[model samples]
Target: MKTNFQKNKIVEHPKESLAPKSGDKKDYTQSEFEEFIIKSGAVGSYMIFRSENEEDEMGISEL
Candidate 1:
């Protein structure tokens, strides 16, 4: 029995499945973002935090 709400439930990509738990705060600087990247360890060897609105992409060769 699928309802309107159930049907309307949007399915996200597997890679983007887990979202940030906290949504209260917004806006992050490049340095802060870089710190997060280091903590997350998304980057294998070389890493660079680009923007706040960007997601850290892993398992890719540095170019």
Candidate 2:
């Protein structure tokens, strides 16, 4: 018996966050991000925004 090691495979790395300013926000959750992906059938990219609330609420949305 011979083993075939010539098969091509792709390895994808975990997505990385952009700048720190966006990450600091705390309103948006991962589920929302995933929902957007599922509803839209795809998510090319996304971004975070800090609202002008007294407590400075933050959330994630499509970029």
Candidate 3:
């Protein structure tokens, strides 16, 4: 079986805060981000990994 997938352009990074900023508040916690994703109609697997440099990373794949 052959599988084909089209690349998607990520206009916004997941780690970026989706809520409007007020004063110096511009970061979203993990739970808040997850909530935003769910509300945005995202349905698939979400993965969190660590890069070779030990920096944390995450991504969401829509199935």
Number of backbone-clashing residue pairs for each candidate, in the order shown: 0, 0, 0
* Better TM-score candidate (1, 3): 1
Model 3, 1-63: lDDT tens per residue? 235697768686677556566685646688998898889966556545667655334443552
Candidate 3: lDDT over CA atoms?
0.64
Which ten-residue region of model 2 has the weakest summed lDDT? 54-63
Rate residue 47 of model 3 by lDDT.
Answer: 45
Q: Residue 38's C-alpha lDDT in candidate 3?
A: 84
Candidate 3 RMSD computed on C-alpha atoms after optimal superposition onto the true structure: 12.3
> By TM-score, is 2 or 3 better?
2
lDDT for position 17 in model 3: 57
Number of clashing residue pairs, candidate 3: 0
* Rank ordering of all candidates by lDDT, starting from the highest: 2, 3, 1
Q: For each candidate in turn, give its C-alpha RMSD to the true structure in angstroms.
A: 14.1, 15.5, 12.3
Candidate 1: 10-residue stretch with minimal lDDT: 51-60
Write candidate 1's Cα lDDT for 1-63 as tens digits: 224654555787577454567774666788999999889975666445565545434333565
- Model 2 steric clash pairs: none
As a whole number from 0 to 100, the lDDT of residue 25 in candidate 3 is: 69
